[model samples]
Target chain A: MHRKLIESFGIRVRQCREKRGWSQERLAEYSGLDRSYVGEIERGRVIASIVTVQKLAQALNIDLADLLTNCGPPSGPGRSN
Target chain B: MHRKLIESFGIRVRQCREKRGWSQERLAEYSGLDRSYVGEIERGRVIASIVTVQKLAQALNIDLADLLTNCGPPSGPGRSN
Candidate 1:
């Protein structure tokens, strides 16, 4: 809900973007979303659906678990893939 | 989409339930979800929404980032919290 949280989400996406050397445009193309919408997501202007997040994770060749984990600490026990 | 993935999500929820020392009934009371629904989630009988995940994280006193991280690996470079 906080701007910072959205930014944090954006930062996570950005990390993936950088990892794949994809611009927002490229990520949109690869992920089958609108380029501007991706920008909004990266800018913390939107709350993405779980499906979209899953698509982003897959397009980035990343796991949703890792993406979520990268942003914060676990509240309880860890899981194994 | 895979059964394993659904089960993984269930496991994540169960970990949080255990962390809070709450049974399905108590967790449902605290999280505003049905008890049987909670059981299904834990048993990998369902895929929860992000809103549900958010509630689970809050009830467990954990960050969403931590919960997600506990589940899997980052396909690309990881981000710092």
Candidate 2:
């Protein structure tokens, strides 16, 4: 489940960056993150910190909710909610 | 901005746990986190990892978007979005 959430976040980050025609390097520049780190994030190789997530959202100029769509646990049966 | 984001997340976590009538120890047990760590997170003294955030959301039985409400930068005139 954690892996899925991380991958979903990475995919969302990649999608948002691609939508703006920004390369990984460009995103790193905008987010003040390392280019390698951005690549790792997009590849789901690292569990990003909340601060890093916020930086990516700001750099993509998107809402945090928008970036986190479908990144939560599925609303299925047997759930406590 | 990073400090603000972390603080906002911490506040949300505390609010959700309180709404459920759960103690920090209970929340920690549910999230498989340390009680002291949960306390620090609620106090905005630590920047939680993405995995930790997901665990908290799941344990709270809330959507990640809901947990992150109002966590993004405000849509002000100077914003790029």
Identify the candidate with maximal TM-score: 2
* Model 1 DockQ, alpha carbons vs. true complex: 0.19
Which parts of model 1 are misplaced by more than 4 Å? A1-3, A69-81, B2-7, B18-21, B28-52, B63-66, B69-81
User: What CAPRI grade goes to candidate 2?
Assistant: medium
TM-score of each: 0.58, 0.84
For A1-81, candidate 2 gives per-residue lDDT tens digits of 899988888997888777666789888988899999999988999999988988877776666666778333222332111
> What digit string (tens of lDDT, one per residue) describes model 2 on residues B10-30?
998888787666799888988
Considering chain A alone, what is the TM-score of candidate 1?
Answer: 0.76
* RMSD (CA, Å), each prediction: 9.8, 12.1
List model 1 lDDT by residue over B14-78, tens digit each.
Answer: 87666555677877877678899889988988766556676666555566655554632221232
Question: What's model 2's interface RMSD, roughly to a tenth of an angstrom?
Answer: 1.1
lDDT of 1 at A55: 65
Highest lDDT: give the candidate number.
Answer: 2
DockQ of each: 0.19, 0.59
